[model samples]
Structures are given as C-alpha cells and as structure tokens.
Target: MGLRFLVVEGNTRGARQAHKQAYGLTLSESYAEVLQEIEGGAVCDIAFPADEGANLPDAAGLESYDGIVLTGSHLNIYDRTPDIVRQIDLMRAVYASRTPSFGSCWGLQVAAVAADGDVRQNPLGREVGFARKLTPTEAGRAHPLLEGRPAAYDAPAIHLDMVTALPGDCTVLAGNAVSPVQAAEIRQDGGVFWGVQYHPEFSLGELAAILERRTDILVREGFCRTPEDALAYTADLAALHRDPTRFDLAWRHGIDAEVLEPQRRTREIRNFVEHRVKTEKSARGRA
Candidate 1:
C-alpha cells in the first residue's frame, strides 16, 4: 500500500493574484501541487486555510497518515494572529500524537515555535528569490535530509520572519549568512519534525512567478534596479535551469557554482520522502 500524507497549508482562504496567474490555483492548492511532486508515490490529502475554519484532524486522524507536510505562509510567526495561533495548536497536537512532519519557510517557523523555539522578523530583511549556499552544519553533514545534498548550494526562497532560537532538543541542520537556521530537525512530545527555512518544494517557474508578483516591492527594496530588472532577474534563474552549458550564467545573477543543479535545489524534499516517509512504510511492513 502507499503511504498516507496530509498537507496543512499555512495560507489563508483567499486566493492571490500571483497564484491565479501562475497556475489558476489558490495559495494552498499550489503548495499541494508541489508537495505532490516530492512525495510522489504517496496518497496525499490537504487541509486548507489553517487559520480560519480549519478542521484539523484529531489525533487518531493524524495517526492514519504516514506523513504530514506544512507549507509556507505570509503570516508572521510572532504576530499572534488567531490563524497563526491555530497553526501553533495544530503543531502541538502533531507532537502529542508523535506524527512525523516536515515543513518549509513559514512552516518551519511554526514548527520551531510549537517545539519551544523562538522566531522574529529578520532584521536582515526579506530573503527574496533564492537563499544561496546554505552550508550544512556538522550535524547536517550526517543528517538524513542532506543525504545527497552538496556541502552548499542555492534553493528557492522568500520570507521575512526567521527562527531566532530553537527548542533545546532541536538540531540545526544548515545555515548561511542570510539565515542562521536554514534548516533543523526537532524532537518533541515523541514526534519528529524536519523543517527548512527555504522552499525546496518550489519550482523555478513558481519562483519567477512569485518574483513577478512582488516586482514593485523588489525594486522599492533595492533588490533590483527597476521592475523590468526584477523580471530580468527571474528570467536569469529560468535560463540557468534551462541550459546545461550555462554554468557560468549564475554568477551574473549572484548564483554561484557551475550551473543550476535541479537536484541541489530539491535536495531536502527528495531526501525527506525517500528516507523518512518511505522508511516508515518499510518499518510498518516488518512489524
């Protein structure tokens, strides 16, 4: 039988213009779509708009699922909004039930908070587009999530809030100059959670769409010389992924290394599925 998984999307109910243009999907829907690509063989289901009117599964309901995925959000972890609070409550339940969970971006912050960690608005400002070369920690070097990850490489990212402190039991996996806690593994209430501050589930096409949606802001934040320049920057990322011989093209857009390696970008997501979730199925069969 296939593994059962649940996707708890952090976005609110309303759809965004950018998402509509990119895939005609609601924010939560798009997240589910990408997650489907990573946990490919699993039977996946989604719980949407976790903040409002969300019907979070009870403990028994959670146990039925082999894995749970938490998607990124615009909500700030420190905001204490009712919706954010609900997500926290859900995270707590995940631990109490010992459910295996994984997360990205806002998803990571929520896990950290629920696990007794701390979060704050990044004083370094928003890390838009991509986070580069998040070097693995000594622990990450041997971590299952970094099973085939390079020592360091870039991944799609866009976030403002970050984890400032982690639960005592949490092991930091990777970090870089931009974000101190780029990824972490947590153990709490008998549950295991793996999370990343970047979006391994995002495709470069999605990243470019996100950049286009935030074009004006990218210019205002001085991330680009102009709105047109922001568009060009997105195009560069696409180019890197498109051509095999364009290894040198990355430097022009601040992307280092020989070329854009798709595997490098999706290192964590594949590892999580192949190692963590699938491993559970094998263990269950043995039992």
Candidate 2:
C-alpha cells in the first residue's frame, strides 16, 4: 500500500489559493504533482470543502489515507462554527483511531484543544519575526524528526496565539523563552501526534512575504513594532534560512554563518508510520 496524507483544510478558498500560488497545485488538480516532488508517496489526500461550511467528509471516508495533516488558517479554533467543530471532531477521531497526524501553526493549537487541552490569546501578542533560538529537550534531541536539527534553529514566526500547554504525555520537543512549547510530540498515545509552532512547509522567502503583507495588521495588533523592523531583522531571518546541518552546528556553538542551506528530512514519515501501525492494529482488534 502507498503512503497517504489526509489534509484538513481550514478554509477551502484560502487553502486552495495558497497551494496553487506557493506550491503550484491548483484546486482542480490532485495534489499529486506537487506532493510527489516535495514528499513523494508520503502524501495522499487533500481534503477541503467544495464550498464554505459544508459538512465535513467522514473519517472512514479517509480510511484509504494513512496520515492526517491539518492546514493553518486565520480562524481561531474556539470560534463557534460548524466547520471548526467538524475539523476538531475529525482530528479527535484521527487520534481515537490512532492515525498518524501532524499540524502546523493553527493546526497545532487546534489539535491540542481537541485532546482535552486548552488554547488562548497568547499574553505575548504576535510572534511576527524570526524566533532565532529554540532549545530542545532531551527527548527533542532523541526525536528522529527533530534530531540533526540545530540545537537551536530559527523559524519565521507569524502567529498571534500558540499552544501554551500540551496534552497529557506530550513532550515539549522545542521551546524558547518567548514560547515555552514551540514543538511537541505525543508518543504515549496509540497514534503519535506531533505539532509545530512554525511552518515547516514554508520556505524563507515565502515566510517573509507573509510577514511583509501583514505588517500593518501585526503592528496595529501589537504583534510587532513595525513592518520594516520585522522584515529587516536579518540576524534572526538569516539564521532561520540556514540549512539544518549548518544551523544546528551554528546553534550549538552560537556562531553565525554567512549563508544558510535548506534542511530536508523525512522524520514526519517515521512518526506517521509509528502512529499508523499502532492505530491499524487497534482498529483491527476492535473490528
């Protein structure tokens, strides 16, 4: 069987446009072409509403897919909407079924809330610039997905809220002074659940564009002082642009590098597999 990824899109219109513009995948196309080049067979389904607030597709509907990935959106999970509830329900069902699941910014927080945790407006407004330093826990160092990642790596941060506390048995994989729980992994559950505060799917230039476009809003909301400051803060952004190996080396020694390299690792697949095997076995027993 081939690996499949069930993508949970928050907003069909915005998500579709993002995929097309950033990854060059149009709404009309199966995510095959773009995903194959980026993640190969590791990616599968890309779920979305044919229109807004449509009923969520069923979980068994996605049985052919092996894993779940929740897309980021501007909406808060706590908002009262059928779509939010449906997405939350689907995520919880994925957990109950032990499906391998991963989430980005908003997706991460939503997953945490669905697992009996909490989400709130961060006391610290928006983390609009590059968070240059993130200290990993011992488990983080051992985590295959995070291992070989710099002791501290920079990520282009552009979120108003974050996962303040994680679900039970969830290990904080990466953190810093500003955000105590930047990355987390729940290994004790039947299906491993992983979430990152940063956008792993985004490249540096893309991240910059996001911050650039939202500068005024970020400032008005007190997420940052100014758009110019956020974008011109090269030290952090430059560090974020570093390749995984070099970034890790620089982070360990606190030395800077002239150029950064992109880091690509398939750790997500490993974590996804771990969850899938556990969930499949559990589902079989129940059957």
Evaluated with TM-score, which candidate comes out highest? Answer: 1
Residue range 57-112, candidate 1, lDDT tens digits? 99899878888888888778788888889999988888887767899998889999
Clashes found in each candidate (C-alpha, N, C closer than 3 A):
0, 4
Minimum summed lDDT over a 10-residue window in model 2 is located at: 257-266
Residue 125 CA displacement from its true place in model 1, Å: 1.6
Where does model 2 exceed 4 Å of error? 12-35, 49-57, 187-189, 221-260, 264-287
Q: Ten residues in a row with the worst lDDT in model 1? A: 256-265
lDDT of each: 0.80, 0.61
RMSD of each: 2.4, 5.6
Top candidate, metric lDDT: 1
User: What are the per-residue Cα lDDT tens digits for candidate 2 across 92-202?
Assistant: 777776666777777788788777677777786667555557678888888755755667776645677877666786788888877888788764346567877766555
Candidates in order, TM-scores: namely: 0.90, 0.73
